[model samples]
Target: MAHPLIDELTDSSFDELISTAEVPVLVDFWAEWCGPCKAIAPILEEIADEHNGQLKIAKVDVDSNQKLALRHQVMSIPTLILFQGGEATKRLVGAKSKRDLLADLAEVISN
Candidate 1:
């Protein structure tokens, strides 16, 4: 089962979503033309479903949302930023495996 993912975000909604989320958030900075971004989409969906109540998976398109992408210093596509308490705690650039993502996410959530 795959959980629903927040596939787009704006500056207006970013604060409310990240700052006010009850659990940790994984924000994926992606673009329509990025192969790696497309590759990781399903994996992200799966993780979201698996950690339904514990975390959130959000996707931001760099091409459409340039401001938001710049704010996060996203120089690369498919960058995953882990947010806790409205602050970015971990940043993973490029595509990563599910096992690595799980381990990294677990480390943050546990702290």
Candidate 2:
């Protein structure tokens, strides 16, 4: 299940959430059948809680948002893309530990 801090985004709301967002939006492109996606959820939830105002965590079901997924070139589930200034700044292809994520995010967000 998605944590309260994590937001579920649809194709319609994708642009609005990412482009106009005050903080960097980490968008998770996932599917219900993806085991890796499930594995990454906890890390993302933790990030959402820890980063709060510094970052915004969001999820988009690839099955439901095919167009958005295709637009983002998400061939793999659990794809994490960080959007800042309305553009993708960093991308992670699969499940990663919180430490690794935090380290990687710090570089992208700090820049």
Candidate 3:
């Protein structure tokens, strides 16, 4: 299981968690078979801890949650989508460095 800061979103809780979140929610779409997803897990964990109040981290298993993935149009693993006010604002595909991730999320924290 992931840390409390990181929420594992399932079909049942996805809409509620993301829609009701006060801060920007970063949803990582991944699968257990994805190496890149596993590689970036720690970075997301760190980000969750570092930006506790400013942001939130969530994960969706594309395998088990196919409908969610299809609706989001996630064609790749480790796709990170930033949700705010129940809408997706940014999409980052593939693995990225912590610095890059932070740079991408600067707007969320700043605004």
Assess candidate 1 and give its lDDT: 0.83
Per-residue C-alpha lDDT of model 1 across residues 1-111, encoded as one tens digit per residue: 323455467766788899888888889999889999989998898887777778888878788788999999999989999998999999999898988878878864432
| Candidate 3: residue 20 lDDT (0-100) | 98
The predictions' CA RMSDs to the true structure, in order, are 2.6, 2.0, 1.5
lDDT of 2: 0.88
What would the per-residue lDDT of candidate 2 be over residues 18-45, giving only the tens digit for each residue?
A: 8899988999999999998889888888
Clashing pairs in 1: none
1 against 3, candidate with superior TM-score: 3
**Model 3, runs deviating above 4 Å:** none
Position 6, candidate 2: lDDT: 84
Tell me, by TM-score, which candidate is best: 3
For all predicted structures, in order, the TM-scores are 0.89, 0.93, 0.95
